[model samples]
Target: MKIDIAELIIVEGKDDVSALKRAVNADIIITNGLGLTKERLKEIETIAKDRGVIVFTDPDYPGSKIRNILKGRIPNCKHAYLNKSEAINPKTGKYGVEYAKPEAIVRALKNAKATVQDGSENYTLTDLVCWRLAGADSQKRREALCNHLRIGQANAKGLLNKLNAYQIPRAEIECFLAEYERGER
Candidate 1:
């Protein structure tokens, strides 16, 4: 089933727009790049005020930079995350939303979460270590956890922040871990 998003979706470029079109039924705006004109920013800001915005960028450093710029300006904008693994183009070794399968894109957008300014911390570093999502021999574990959680890949700290920002419950984490332990993943 195609997901329908009311918010104006923001992406990096034309290809990302095309990919989103295949995955969802929504209006989209392309940022083009870091060089967003003041006028364009104003336009987007106005649109954001009228209709909420969802920042769905590539899962890469440059994409993160663009997302950060938008986040700084539009604190209330929701965020959709594609796992780095999902966004990678194996043949070209490129990483972007354009390379992700339409199904993956749909899944990511479906999992989009609103940022909570005054959120409670649901998990801590100790929890990450106890869950085997941090420290040596934990890279693969962390990746699996992030993919399963659909929050995108991150270091221990970022993962913790997302766990809280997305308001994911401690019980949910425990349940997922329990399933993972049982090889039900």
Candidate 2:
């Protein structure tokens, strides 16, 4: 069934917003990871109260983390995880749903699942880091301090200066990232 959802996609950067707009007709909002402040949530909640709001994000670790964060702030905000295979190339593994082809984008929307809503669910800093690493490409250097860790390439470099190393090995970290990317765990 085709769900004509008039949802808004909250993303971490302009590129994400642009890519999503190109692929879908939904409204796009860029949070810039300021942690969904009270005012922002209020604005989002106001919109969601009447219409369905689907929080579409990158199919990486950070994307999921963003969903979790949004869940805490916005009521009636549904979440959708993009199918990495359909939205991205499994071989080259260039991450992000924007990389998805036309048909792939259609399939992604068709297969989108409802976001599980729960108030008490909480994610730790470690979880955020893991999400960032998982969202990264396999061949890319797993720099914990790299800006591109989570918010994505457009924003990663600037944030990199503010991040600290957690002693996460490139390979081990990639494995953790892979679990989410491949939807295995």
Candidate 3:
């Protein structure tokens, strides 16, 4: 089934392009792994300016790094995130967009989030700790929160940066946490 998509998706490699093809019908540009050249960046910038760009990289460190680089160059680029667990193939023990199910890929694309580059700080480290999203023992909690928020997994500092970048309100976080607790109970 061919699903129509308007934006151009920026992926890591050919496998990602193939995986995305299984999910939706859209244009894609491969970054050819992490070694993004200036020419490629220029092309990406041109495409982004023309048809818009959605940065959908893998859930690993390299993926995040590439996404960050793209974001720096192309502000306001939309971001689609898949949880590491969702992207990991249990049989092969490999993690990538190619390993994610079609439904997961579609959902991530549909729920893509845009970065808020405004210089405004909403929450602090204290807030993260209070919400059980920081410190050594908060890994599980952080993962749950990230999944619920569709923010993907991150360490304390990274999560904080995401919170700030997304400009998520405190009340919204509290409501999600309360709902999560109710579901857990």
Q: Over the stretch 1-185, how does candidate 3's per-residue lDDT look in tens digits? A: 54556677899999999999998867688999898999999988876775578999999999999999999999979999999998998998888998988888888988894322233356789999898878878897788888977767899999997786455678878888887778861
Q: Per-residue CA lDDT of candidate 2, range 1-185, in tens? A: 12223455576677766666565555567776545577877667765664456776777887778788878777567666667775675777777756766555545555654322332223334554555633456224334324333423433433332232122244654565566467554
- The 10-residue segment of model 2 with minimum total lDDT is 159-168
lDDT tens digits by residue: candidate 1, 114-154: 32222224578898999998888878777888898777899
lDDT of 1: 0.79
Q: Candidate 2, overall lDDT?
A: 0.55
TM-score of each predicted structure versus truth: 0.59, 0.49, 0.60
Which candidate's lDDT is highest?
3
The per-model lDDT (C-alpha) reads 0.79, 0.55, 0.83
Give candidate 2's root-mean-square deviation (CA, Å).
Answer: 19.5
**Residue 127, model 2: Cα distance from true site in angstroms:** 50
Q: Candidates 2 and 3: which is better by lDDT?
A: 3
**Stretches of candidate 1 above 4 Å error?**
114-185
The collision pairs in model 2 are: 134-177, 147-156, 147-160, 148-156
